[model samples]
Target: MTEENFLLSRVKRFVGSLAHCRLLGVTVVSAEPNSLCLELPYSEAIVGNPDTGVIHGGAITTLMDTACGSVVICALEDFELCPTLDLRVDYMRPARPGEPVQARAHLFRQTQSILFARCEAVQGERTVAHCSATFMRIGKDASPKAYRDYITSGTAMENS
Candidate 1:
C-alpha cells in the first residue's frame, strides 16, 4: 500500500473496533494526512431536548473528539494507541433535528509525545460546535499485541 492508503487503513481499523463510536453511528467521511472528517447521524435515542428535538451536546462532543484523535493517528508516521489528554468543546448552536452532524478535525501541532488538534462540527452551513484537544502519543513499544492485532484484523475484515 502507498503511504496514504496505509494511513487510512490504520484509521479504519482503529475506528471499526471502537464500540462507542459504532454505537454513536459515526461514519468516516474522509481521511488524509493531518486531517479527518466524520459524521454522526441523527437518532431519537441521542436527543437531549425532546421539545426542541436537538441532539445531545455530549454526542457532538464525542464526534469531535473521535475525529480529533483519528486526525492525530493519521498525522503520525506509524500507528500507536493515543488517548485524549484534554478536550474542550464550545457549542455555538444546537444541532438541527433530522440532520446529520459532520465533524472535521485538523492536526495543528505535534511534539515528541503530544499532539494538538482542532475540530468543528457542522450541520448544513451552520457551525454547531467547535473543539480543541490534546493527546498523548504513546510509543509503539507500549502498545499491546492484542490491540495491534485487532487493528490489523479489523482492517482485513473491512476489505473483505
Candidate 2:
C-alpha cells in the first residue's frame, strides 16, 4: 500500500475496534497525515427522540472527540496515548432525523506534551456541531500495548 493508504488503513482498524466505536458503529471514512473523518451510522440504538429519530447529542460528541484523537494518531510520528484535557463543542443544529453523521477533525497544533484540534460534525448538507479539543500527550510506553500491536501486526486478538 502507499504510505497514505497504509496509515489510513491502520488508523481505521485501530479506531474502529475501540469498545465505544464498536458499540456506536463508528467507522473511519478517511484519514491523512493530520486529519481524519469518521462516520456514525444512524440507528435506533442511538436515537434520542423516538418520535423524531434524532441522534443523541452525546453520540455526536463522541464522534467529534474520536475524530480528533484519531487525527492525533495520524499526526504523530509514533503512536502514543493522548487523553482529552478538554473538549468544547458548539451545536449548530440537530442532525437530520434519519441520516448518518460524519465528523472531520484537523490537528491545529502539536507540542511536546499537548495537541490541539478542531472538528465539525455534519449530516449531508447540514451542520450538526463543531468541537475544539485539547489532549495531553502521554508518552508512547504509557499506553496499553494491545492497540499498538494490533496496528503493527495487522492481526486481531481476543481481549483478555
Candidate 3:
C-alpha cells in the first residue's frame, strides 16, 4: 500500500475503536498523512430543534473536533496522548434534516509538543461549520498496549 493508503487504514481503524465515535456513528470516509474525512449519519438522536428538525450545534462541534484530533494522529509518526489545548468552532449554517454531515480536517502545523488543525463540516454542498484546534502532544506513556496497536486491532475486528 502507498503511504496515504496506510495512513487511511490506520485512521479508519483508530476512529472505529473509539466508543464516542461509535456512539456518534462517525466513520472514516478518507484519510491521509495530514488529513482525514469523516461522516456522521443523520439520526433523531442528534437533532436539537424539534420544530426545525435541525441537528444540534454540539454534535457538529464534536464531529469537527474529533476530525481534528484524528488528523493529528495521522500527522504523527507514532501514537502519542495528544489532548486538546483549544478548540474553536464557527457555525455557518444549520445542517439540513435527514442529510448526513461530512467533516474534513487538515493538519496545518506540527511541532515536538503541539499540533494545529482545521476542519470543516459540510452537508452536500452547503458548509455547516468550521473549526480550528490546537493539541498538546504529551509523550507516549502507555505501558502495555500502544494506541496504534489497539487501533490497528480494530481493523481485525472489522474483518471478523
Candidate 4:
C-alpha cells in the first residue's frame, strides 16, 4: 500500500480498538503523515441538555481529545503510546442537535519524548470548539500491546 493508505489503515485500526472512540461514534475521515480528521456523528445519547437539544460539552471534549491522541500514531515513525500530558478545550458554543461534529488534529511539534497537537471541533462551517494538547511518548515496548498489535501488523480486530 502507499504511505497515505498505510498510515490511514493504521490510524483506523488504532481508533477502532479504543472503546471510548466507539462509544462516541468516532470515525476517521482522512489521515496524512502529520494530520488527521475524525468525525463524531450526533446521537441523542450525547445530548447533555435534553430540553435544549445541545450536544454535551463532554462529548465534544472527548472528540477533541481523541482527535489529538490519534494523530500521534501518524506523527511517529514507529507506533508508540503517547498519553495526553495536557489538553485544554475552549468551548465556543454547543454543537447543534442532530449535526455531526468533525475534529481535525495536526501534529505541529515533537521532541524525543513529547508531541504537541491542536484541534478544532466543527459542525459545518462554524467552529464549536478548539484545543491545544501535549502527549508524552512511550516507545512501543512500554505501550499497550493490544493497541500496538491492532495498529500494526495484519490482525486488527474488526469489531474491537
Model 2: per-residue Cα lDDT over 1-160, one tens digit each: 3767877987887786689999998998888888888999998888989888888899999899899888987888777878999999999999987789999899999999999999999887778899999999989889667767677556665584
| Clashing pairs for predicted structure model 3, backbone only | none
The local distance difference test score of each candidate is: 0.84, 0.87, 0.85, 0.88
Better of 3 and 4 by TM-score: 4
User: Candidate 3: lDDT of 140?
Assistant: 68
lDDT of 4 by residue, 5-124 (tens): 888998888888789889878999998998999999999989999899998999888989999998988888788878889999999888889899999999999999889999999988
* Candidate with maximal lDDT: 4
The lowest-lDDT stretch of 10 consecutive residues in candidate 4 is 151-160
TM-score list, all predictions = 0.89, 0.92, 0.90, 0.92
Clashes of 2: 0
Order by TM-score, highest first: 4, 2, 3, 1
Model 1 Cα shift for residue 33 (angstroms): 0.3
Residues 89-120, candidate 3, lDDT per residue (tens digit)?
99998899999999999999998888999999
lDDT per residue (tens digit) for residues 52-140 in model 1: 99888999988998899889777876667788999999999888899999999999999998899999999878999999999997787
Instruction: Give the better candidate number (1 or 4) by lDDT.
Output: 4
Alpha-carbon error at 56 in model 4, in Å? 0.5
lDDT, candidate 1, residue 95? 88
